[model samples]
Target: MGTIVKQNKQLYKAISENKRFSLAIFICFMAILKIQYSNVESTEYLGIADTKEININSSHSVKIRNIHVIPGQTVEEDELLMELERPDLDLRIYELESQLNELKAENSFNSEMNKELKSVKVSNNENMDSPLQIKINSMTKQLIILKRKKADLFVFSKRAGVIGSINVKVGEDASPFTPLITMHDSAPSMIKGFIHESIYNKTYKGQKVVVTSISDPNKIMDAVVASVGNRIVEYPVRLRKSEASVTYGREVVIFVSKDNPFLIGEKVQIKSFEKPNEIMTAHAQAVPVRKIEDVIDLEIGVDIENTKVEPSGLVYIKDLNQTVMISDDTGRKDRPYIYTVNNSGLIDKEIEIEGVKAISDMEAISMDENGIIYIASSMSEKKNGKVSDKRKKLLMIERNDFNFKAIGEVNFYDALNKVAKSNKSEEWAQVLLAKGNKKIRINIEGILVKENTMYFGLRSGSKLTKDQFVLLKINDIKSVFAKNAIDADQISIQANVAFPIDSDFKNEGVSDIALINGELYVLTVNNTGKEGGRVLKTVLADPSNHMTELKRFKGLKPEGITYDTSASKFLISFDQGDKKSKLLLVDKF
Candidate 1:
């Protein structure tokens, strides 16, 4: 009986020990699995370092007529790269043109016949919408549409880039689905990457990341996260650890210096530095806070020019205690003169620019410390898409006593061509000369002369991207503009710097620029007919720093800005459409 009881106790003890040991092993297994999962959710992510691709295609079936550019050729924005034509489209256009001509002849004959009849009035024939007139109008519309279609066959580069590939031959038949040409941005400033969801919360915009080349780890660079996607996206096959495994994460874009030493389409590994809270705090603090105040309209007028003042540039004249304002020669009929307005908003004097055959497009005005005045034209194509010689002059004026006399005029076209060629930026001059669209047209909207250096601010955004604006500098202004005939070689191109554009005001371009106490302020106008603008602040020395919007105005088209040192405020000029332009004093800018 004693031996049986002892055996049962031993069996119970042994079973309890086995259960405890199995529980411990299971716990250890789960801990090991957790560690492996954490390792898979790594800080490193596969990234593609490449320039943005711009694919050029045709909307309809067409045959290539000519190819002007070869593969790996550098092209300027709006440069004619290829020519294409469709036989079917040409035939349709020809038929429409014939129909239009026949209708016009018939309409003219009918009008003459109606004049001979007593019941039909000659005025009625002109105003009445008869069946023949309706037919003519419809035919005209059709003809215009067909002609526009034919014009699209001529392919122009939409941006400045290098020709990546030409997919079709010169005489190959291609459809809308076929990409005729591929262009890659000349600068690889961005990297595309993805992050796993498990560590998404730790990553943020503006965070510093170290990028390493997969094949050569020694080639590494530091970059900043420009943006992060809002939603999760499936990882690309190249980024996945296993080809068959599916995974998702958020998209991220990293910005690097334009001169980074990396080849396009190279595979890289990006490791994020864990600093989410710190980065968010820094970005939030960078934005400046200000209130939008009411624009105090100063009823200013220049009566010598009966037309609307339509002021485009303004500069403060302390010697005369007045402001000198200039109007753009957009109408091409107005007399060119700079009018000095007193503090009371009345024209005190009119100074005419001598030795010029006609009024030029005076877009900006600046005054040096020695009282030398400089007036800059738009230096771009006319509003009618025609090239004008009168719009390419930069006049230098000297104020003697109370009169401003024109000293000399610089041929901007010749000077810019020389500067661009020397700097290997012939594309800049090409874009300025291109006349089809206004968005890419290079216009000088702001001029600033400080310490003998001249800074010309561009009104158009960057040709490659809208997220940047350009400022071209000319060192030693006196050496460039001769007393009589200026030579192109005398003009010194110091630098062509691109500043970060303010993204808050979408589709807005620089209308004017002013410098006060070494800080740069720019006024941008909406190009979408919204009749509004924003005042932004930036530093010229640091082009990488983004601009901050100081103030935004609605229902006003701000065209000019000048800082009043004595008053300690900014004076802005506006275009009032039918009414004369007025000046506004912004107390806090």
Candidate 2:
């Protein structure tokens, strides 16, 4: 009976130990749940916010007198950025005015002389005897030009933003063609993220989310959903540090708190729930998330049936949230025009330019911060034996109250050719020209202005490669504008690459280039073959790597590319190659 009692006690002890073990395991399991899949925390969508840069370029070659704002200072729109010392400009204006006044006095004397002569039938026809009046009209036009030149001397900030860089100082000469500074928009930095498809429904616009630094756990912040993408996209490797070999997900764009102390390009974690708006911060929280400003919805990409622009390109005007597309349509009768449109693809107004500036086969277009539009004219031709004008020039235009007028133009032909030859493109170009008895025209397919530099994508290739190999050359816009020739020291050739990210990719040359927040995107096309077109993305920070194909764009021969920040999509135009040109929008951009 004693033995039986001892065995019962042992059994009870074993049961007690088992219960303790079971309780400990349950505690650990619950702790892991709180850490990993907490309803309040999610690591699915993660990214960092970055501010966009606005380049401010000088428009005239003049001596600067005073610099108003220093680096890191915020400036209002139209604020005086710098003052120019132009005694010569003032003297020229005065001289023109003096000439005008003298001509007016002479005209008054001539009128009296003509009246007396007409009474006697000596000078009956004023049209034949109005040399003085012609001189007076000429002087008046000269005076107007001198006054406009004087106005260009006083430079102003194009938009309200924080000055990030200052390349020119007081008492120095600044040229209109070169960038003098760059500014960061006054708006807060933005984070573009991607969410796993499994939890994408838990993410949405206006949803409240927490952003925690992956590098520093104590650095916590908040963000609000600005946009949630509609389609699944390839996960950008830069957005996360993942071990997964294959990655695809939906995207979300968030506006980080204005006061958030996160560095640009740094990775962070984002946690979101179903009811995003309900999770907004309560009153006592430090660094409250700023309400996202209502970004004007510029209804972009909804194509209007009869609007076709060939060899086309368009740029976004951020200050006004407007879009301007200039056509290179060389008509047999009239000059080409610029098309300004509203959000609904309705052509608002048309501005006609002179025939000479709007030359035939003007392929590429870009814009500056001062609202100046630059259109590239490919005037070079292969003649009987030599290259005629072997260069490209720019047509400059600026907006007036209701229309746009050709402000001025500066030659960029010598600059572009010099850069191309320096990059070793000249010899191979000659070989292509020699391949056939017929004259082969070399043309620039696209142009992009990024900060202080210009990227030109050439359509014709060298060494009998034609479209198989593309020649890309970049010019320091400042040096190109400051001097008529591209600085030989500043030219760099982009590496020729065939995007092989997809299994069925073809060797299409680059047709266009667009830089978004320092990340470069290229439009590639194999127009002669089955590979129609595609857009590729390359991280500027890691340029040595091959460009990763972003999306296969089946649009009709898309030849030009630009990004519309307000719409958050890439806008492209087709050459249509003798057909009606069309515009295509890529929402997955």
Candidate 3:
């Protein structure tokens, strides 16, 4: 009877332990849920806002008389920031006015002489039509223009801001091209975020917000809206959720503490304390990351007039153990030439391309197994929106006895237009070709030819789709060079595969693309002041449009990329504006 009692006690103790363990697990699960909810509640919509840099420029060439404000000094609008003087300009004005008065007096004398001659019935046609009258009129206009220069002698503050720098001193000549002083606002550092039109009514002056750094969410501060824009403006390309589509929003300036630690031009997020999830998200949910493990920098040894060549395309030659590169800019003194660079990044030889006058914006180069070479142009509009005929060409050349000769060449712009029309997709192609709402200009930066197929990578996403990076594919591209294929439809569009990401920023585009071991690789670059480059890889057979980012780099404007078998790695060539072009050997990604 005693033994049975003990067994019952032990069973009851085990049950109690099990209950305790279960309760502990339940508490942990609830804690995890609470943490996740807290994160979601704190999430904010992304935007870019920074302190505005205002430049104080010289209206004309003038000598600085005095500087009233020092660096980091605060001043009001219309206040004196600097004083300028120009004795040379004053003397020129005096000279012009004196010339004008003399011409007028000479004209009056000629008129009097003509009147006397007429009264005496003597022929006076020469005096009446004398050139003195014309000279007087011209001088008077010139004197008036010269006198206007006096206004620039006394420079005033353009706005109420803080002085950033004093570029000129007393007696120093300042030109219109260089700013005499740089200034920024004195107001507490604020964020200039864009809110959609739909949420415009929800936002108002004095609305409370939680500001967070896009790069670091841990850095957060409480802020309030200072002002709301009266009219809606288009969102910037980098802040837009869909770069291929147009979006409008009202600019909202949120004032944060003066001691806030946000850098200028750094992108941040602004969230209202209430209704955090009510507004539309402007930027992507994921932040940009640099995936490159290490970057190897190399300098170009050759120089052109003390400036290095701007390399735009690269291709590896296995037999020569060297790489062939092309420059986008060539002088009129010489024809476009392909440069051969050794492993040490020194130019070994220059092979001039025959039958080609000049190349503009030569972006990509590829070579086939049979020693045939192909070079592609950018085919995009310039900043002024005009397309260059020289940049819209594609050339094919062959090497025989170390001499390169042109085999075939075509205007790729017209060819693309014809193919679009034949496919009954001209409407979509027009959007890609032009610049307007929901349109991205065609900027082909990368080209690769494999067997009978050719692929072209667009710097901006194609207009055919709204959210995918596009590649223009053509079948039998080489058949156009055949004797009978001149009038044939050998260049019909075959397909356009899409990449997953469309985060396009201003001046950001695909720098290059390469086909290695039947896999396609893309390199995206940003030439602006922010963001570096991203390398992405994906297979052509990826029906689901899966893309994997392999590497990222900064401080280099990568313009060309190629796979080198000898090194078993990838080489990227950079176009350093005004500086020498550089070569980067990337570690295996």
Per-residue lDDT tens digits for candidate 3, residues 1-589, read 9999999999999999999999999999999978745534422456665665767776567788888989988887679877787787888988888777787787777667757675565345655455775576677777766766676567787446789899888888877668888988654356888888777776676455667788987766655566689999998888887889888988887655445767666788887634344322223242222123334333332222112467888888776667888887754433467787644454545577876766677888888767788998888878896667788778889876557778878777766655554444443455454433333357778888888667777765345443345566666777655422322244333235444454543355567888777787777776344547777787765523567778666766778888778867687787777766677666567
Worst 10 residues of 1 by lDDT: 280-289
TM-score of each: 0.45, 0.43, 0.45
Q: How accurate is candidate 3 locally (lDDT)?
A: 0.67
Clashing pairs in 2: 58-176, 59-176, 60-176, 392-413, 415-486
lDDT of 2 by residue, 1-589 (tens): 9999999999999999999999999999999977753434334567765666767765556776887889989887679988776777788888878878887877777667757775555453564357776777767878887787687677787556789898888788876666777888554466778887777777766566777778987777655566689998888777645756557778887765345667767687887644323343423132332222211212212112123445456676776566666665644422556655443333344455632433555667777666666777654454663343413456666765445666555466554544454444344334333244233345566676666566666655434343343434545565554456655556555544445545444556666666666787777777454537777777553444766667675535666667678877666665655565555555664
The parts of candidate 1 lying over 4 Å away from their true place are 1-302, 329-334, 418-441, 461-464, 483-504
lDDT of 1 by residue, 481-566 (tens): 75333333433323244333445456666778777778887777876656788777887676436577787777788888887777
Candidate 1, residue 495: Cα displacement in angstroms equals 8.4
* lDDT (C-alpha, whole model) for all candidates: 0.70, 0.61, 0.67
Which portions of model 2 show Cα errors greater than 4 Å?
1-308, 333-336, 353-357, 378-391, 400-408, 418-441, 464-475, 501-507, 529-531, 541-544, 577-580
CA shift of 368, model 3, Å: 1.8
